[model samples]
Target: MLKTFRISAILEGISYLLLFSFSMPLKYWANITEPNIYIGYVHGFLFIAYIILAVFFAVDKKIAPKKGIMLVLASLLPFGTFYMDRHYLKPLSAS
Candidate 1:
């Protein structure tokens, strides 16, 4: 579960970056909307999956509720999941 969450977090983070950095720019600057639509759907799915997995892992591991909330909240910010993975999830997995 932990491993799955870690991978999901990374994928989710990448998708978020791609949506903002690539898709949004393409839509606004290049006057193209197709890529954003596709990327948005993908990002949306990944975001939901990440949340579900994070909650499951947190509950299974009995992580503190505050940390669990933080984990979910991290997914909202750019590069936040990567930071959480490195600082929190990775260490938890290592042990």
Candidate 2:
């Protein structure tokens, strides 16, 4: 369970980075207007998967519903998932 969370967390982190980097060029760079459609699609899928994985982990581990929902929301905020992993998940794994 912990291993699954770790891998999902990493993938979620990378997906967030890709989304931010891609969005910058998409909005600001007029010269380089073309966006990587494939990357966008991949990140979208990964984002969904990451949320599903988080829910599964939370339910299996009996995490409170509110906390589980917060964890999912963290994925949407910049670097929030990293903070969640460090503070919320690390100690769970340690035990």
Candidate 3:
């Protein structure tokens, strides 16, 4: 369960980065203007998968509802999942 959650979180982060940092820009700033349908679809599916996996893991681990929700929500923002990893999921590193 832990391993699966970790992997899903990473994939979620990748999808978020691709959508915000790559796909969205391509449709706007870069003037690609086509929406890069492939990236959009990929990110959409990954986002759904990430949400499902997050719930599964939270249930299996008996995590509190609020904390679990926060973790899942992190996937929505750019670099947020990675931030969750550093601050919440993993043990803090020595300075």
TM-score of each: 0.97, 0.83, 0.82
Cα lDDT of model 3 by residue, 1-95, tens digit: 66666667788788778777877889887889556678788778888888898888789778899989998889877888888777766652222
Model 1 C-alpha lDDT per residue in residues 13-73, reported as the tens digit of each score: 9999999999999999999999999999999999999999999999999999999999999
Per-residue lDDT tens digits for candidate 2, residues 7-74, read 78777887778767775477566545345566677778878988889989988989899999988998
lDDT, residue 27, model 2:
52
Q: Whole-model lDDT, candidate 2?
A: 0.80
Model 2 clashing residue pairs (backbone): none
Error of 1 at 6 (Å): 0.2
Stronger candidate by lDDT (1 vs 3): 1
RMSD in order of candidates: 0.6, 2.0, 3.3
Top TM-score model: 1
Runs with alpha carbons beyond 4 Å of true place in candidate 3? 33-35, 92-95
Ranking the candidates on lDDT from highest down gives 1, 2, 3
Which regions of candidate 1 fall more than 4 Å away from where they truly are?
none
Query: Which ten-residue region of model 1 has the weakest summed lDDT?
Result: 86-95
